[model samples]
Target: MKILIVEDEPELLKVMSVFLEREQYVVERATDYASGLSKIANYTYDCILLDVMLPGGSGISLLRALRDMGKLDSVIVVSAKDAVEDKVQGLELGADDYLAKPFHLSELLARIKTVIRRNNQHREQALEFKNVKLFPEDRKLLVNELEVCLNRKEYDLFYYFMIRPGKLVPKTALAEAVWGDSADQADSLDFIYSQIKNLRKKLKDSHAEIDFQAVYGIGYKLM
Candidate 1:
């Protein structure tokens, strides 16, 4: 899964990034309000760790902006200001949870997992499409109660698809979401094609009812 940390404290940011990376998450960082807003506007994340006091603005403003944009990305406000009103304001603005500074990294991990689990469950049957089931927290996939083991890239690819279901997903969006900033340097989308081919075969082997319908020169839609 991916997480965005909007924090200005260099040490705290580094520690959090290193710890989350060790836990096998794709971590992205923004030091201040502008970059945070830009990323929130352009990308989708499993969760966001928002610092209440930002370099250029208040994290409350960012949270409001996110909800205003109608994006449901999970947010956990991590800040030194642990006043009752601060927590209340953050939650009222749609933050999923709040953590004060001086928190244990392990506690943060647990909170992240909790929020993500809650978000996925709230996403209508844990993002099920037909007979297929995807457990994002476990990185597990099931078809007809049979488990299908996928490589890292394949899981990432299908996760994106499972979330969107029948909707057409652009290839560029897929690359950016799955491969992050590295997708911008790709010479071609051949890698995406390869991943899709593998996932399709796996689904067929597992007797999954869903299949990918490629839109020539465009992207793919689950059919």
Candidate 2:
């Protein structure tokens, strides 16, 4: 899973990023409104932790901008302001949940999971593609009704492909999704090649019905 934390508090931002990274999530941080808006404009995330009060602009306005773009990334308003009106405005603008300041990290994590689950409810708890089944919450995969053991990166890569079955997934996008913002600093996509090679071998060895087909000078597509 990938998460973006739009917070101005240095300590809190570090804490949230560290905790979510420990939970196996690719976490990106934006300290103020401008940077947060830029991230919203450029990248995508499974969930966004937005702080209502920001240095350059209000998070409420940022929320409005997100709605205008029609991006349905699950958002949780993390603000010091606990006013009912504020909550109403945020919910009205399309926030999935709200977390007040001085909150427990455990509760924040729980809320993040809940919001993501709710957003993906249409797909149910498990994602299915041909004979492959992936339980996101449990981080498990099954093929032909038998469990397939996958390491963390393998599962993340396969899950990304599973959700967008048959769609062309660019190598850059795949790297960013699995490796997070740091992927941009890499000199080459050799690491991605290594992971994909192993993933393809595993799928073939398991006799899976679906497979990844390279798109020639582009990327791969699950077919």
Q: At residue 151, give the lDDT of candidate 2.
A: 91
Worst 10 residues of 1 by lDDT: 119-128
Q: Compared to the true structure, candidate 2 yields what TM-score?
A: 0.94
Angstrom error at residue 68, model 1: 2.3
* Pairs with backbone N, CA or C atoms under 3 Å apart (clashes), candidate 2: none
| Model 2 lDDT per residue over 1-223, tens place | 8899999989989999999988989899998899999989888889999998899999999999998999999999987745677688999999999888889989988999899988974468788888988899899988898888899899889888988899999988998889986686788887877998998888888888988899877889999
**What local lDDT score does residue 25 receive in model 2, on the 0 to 100 scale?**
93
Query: lDDT, candidate 1, residue 197?
Result: 94
Q: Model 1 segments beyond 4 Å from truth? A: 121-127, 181-187
In candidate 1, list every pair of residues with a backbone clash.
none
lDDT of each: 0.88, 0.89
Off by over 4 Å in 2: none
| Clashes per model (N, Cα, C within 3 A) | 0, 0
**RMSD in angstroms, candidate 2?**
1.5
